[model samples]
Target: MSGPGYRRVAVPVDGGDLAVGVWEPAGETKGTALLVHGVTSSHLAFTHLARRLPGLRLIAPDLRGRGGSHAVRGPAGMEAHARDLVAVLDAFGLESVPVVGHSMGAFVAVVLAHRAPDRVTGLVLIDGGLPLAAPAGLSAEDTVAAILGPTAARLSMRFRDVDAYLDFWHEHPAFAGRWTRELEAYFAYDLVPGDGGLRPATSYATTVDDTIDLTTGDALREALASLDTPTLMLTAPRGLLDEEPGLYEESRLATMLAGLPAVRHQRVEGVNHYTLVMSPEGADAVAPAVAGVLAGERSTA
Candidate 1:
């Protein structure tokens, strides 16, 4: 975290250390907030968010089996992740804070709030949170494949060097013309030395375990059914590939959110799933959204 106003902290959990990224303003501050990155993403993903909200202290962690915490032990599931997050809160000696989660991180936020409702004051879900509809009768493996597409495949890829990895993401549809220095740093942080070359630090097995659990596990179902936390869901119009309708199709989201009056949904224009938080245009929408969450206000973007 050589970037301005950022520092790293290691919070010990049951199985291993949770790598946390803390960003503080150079001067006065408003308060603190917890940020949870997407599956396969590291705490660095929130670098842009941290800069935009400099007045607010930001705490983001590399979840078990991802980023610097990739080796953290234990099964991958929502409950397990929630427990790790609770440990992070305890380490900071903070009772509760507003939470902002991106992609799969939003799923973790839901469970975190449900299991330890007192630990989260409000939730800001970026391009995720409400569950995606799993195709009927699909096997768990197939579900992972169908849902994640190229994202899951990248874990198996080996890059000859840093440039090769950057080349890979450089061609990604979601990031076309949206690249930045932060994006460069993000992809570089993803690599760890492998047997023959540099491979991504995120564990493939853990990704499978988490994807299966989030898609079919009972934990998420139980959590959302009883969820009462103040939450706002911001969605990107496009998905991981810059495809239309995103993870939550317009018609589908309306139906899925119908039952949960406690949750609110707002669609952000001109961004894909990856850009909704990582890019400047997306951050313009997302950073201000946090203000409403902390103020306990219900409004649309």
Candidate 2:
């Protein structure tokens, strides 16, 4: 399907290149937004959001060990991911800009704003940012498995062809009844030929490292503790599997926000964690808050 056009750039980093997808506004740009995707997703995941906000220049990057940057070696984690974001900004000659992240990307955005506050003007976190509750005594690997579920499992699975991969996602709980051509593009971009078949572009090992860091490491805590930038978090009522009481429990989220009064919270209805930014309805629910945040206005849904 036809949509907003974007240009790709390969930003040089320490280990390898970070692939950045840049979308420029049709006319004059209102501002710039750096879009970060979730653990097992890619830069193309922002297609819907980019189309929704045509006035803003959107910059999305395939983080190390994911998407076109799959060859990028790492010790992947929030800190390292944050550093790669800084490199993307530097490559574009941007000193600071509003940062928007979804799911795991939310953790990366917080760490970026925390570590390089001078490089971020504001933050919009969709369906993530706050610490996730992990059961005591769970190892990092186990935590990744539990949190990601089928999404993680797909990383190791091989597909006979592109259509086979599409069929798999067609049945995903999060995308059920909401699939669109935009999503098809995003999914198709995730495939890479390997071992006489196709596999997801994101590295399973990298996802594991990132999951452990966000859930168990101290970087997120430090980032949240020192959060000074204007931050807004939008949560989905459902999760990846379309289950109730998504990623963050309501009462638990309230308690977490009680400490960081500066970060405002808003609930977006009818969308799951994945659709919060990937679906048209989800983008409609989110674009306003994102625009409001960038415009220096507080928005609620």
Candidate 3:
């Protein structure tokens, strides 16, 4: 049987309630898998995967800055996101859920698994997890700047109306080819009427700050090294950046990640960074890989 449709739920975390979209299967399953979306993206990114994983309970959060969970204040860094995931688990009374992260969320998953090994049963890293390849003399600032690209360009939309803001995203190149009624509805849910226009429910500054923090490679590697949770690191042939070859070279990513014990690396050819997470093709490839990893873990247990 196929996975059920997503149910919107608010998970309390400290002072704020983080919004999560859950898609659980009809019958008994192995375990819950928490799906974390990348920066600037929302739970909507997992629409395809939610439909595919019929036997697993899927919990996808809006993180803190991207979707319905944007009410949070302060710098929404990886640690904050990781803590939020823990809070969600606590609220759900679930121990050791398999946490799947895409892009920036992937890094957050790694960090969460590292910080709270007992909380995360397994980790699925999608098109993220490895550090970017650095040149001989490139500074951290330069490396971060390269990762940000134009998507990091400041954009404050003084929308003529909420529909205008919705239209803006509808026509966006990143989303243009894949716009669906579900995504359209997801976009609309996160737009709030503001001072004569609509502003994203999320804080722009919070998003930017999170982006800056995640691009750095130093603390993440340290965190990954500490993670004893079973990890499934899936890399897209195309990187997160629109570049054909991504920041994490397949050979290099596997080689570097090999140092981490019990980590399985899979190279999914033909999908780019973003599409690899959002596309139906990506869901098809990723869902089975995740299921296989979980199955292998169960066998070992």
lDDT of 1 by residue, 182-243 (tens): 99999999899987899999998999899988888888899899989988999988998999
lDDT of each: 0.89, 0.89, 0.74
* Location of the lowest summed lDDT over 10 successive residues in candidate 2: 292-301
- Give lDDT: candidate 3, residue 234: 84
Candidate 1 lDDT for residue 59: 92
TM-scores, all models, native as reference? 0.96, 0.96, 0.85
| Cα lDDT of model 2 by residue, 195-240, tens digit | 8699999999999999999988899989999887889999999998
lDDT of 2: 0.89
After superposing candidate 1 on the true structure, give the runs of residues whose Cα lies further than 4 Å from its correct spot. 1-4, 297-301
- The sequence of per-residue lDDT tens digits that candidate 3 reaches over residues 1-301 is 3448558889887558888888877677666788898777788888877777777788888888667887765557788888999988887788877788988888898888778888877888988765656444555445444675544442355576667767776655555476566566666776766686776666667766665666553457678667677788888776654466765776777678778886778888767787676777778899997787677668877
Q: How close is candidate 2 to the true structure, as a TM-score?
A: 0.96
**What value does the lDDT take at residue 188 in candidate 1?**
96
- Model 3 bad stretches (over 4 Å): 1-3, 133-145, 161-179, 217-219
Candidate 1 whole-model C-alpha lDDT, 0 to 1: 0.89
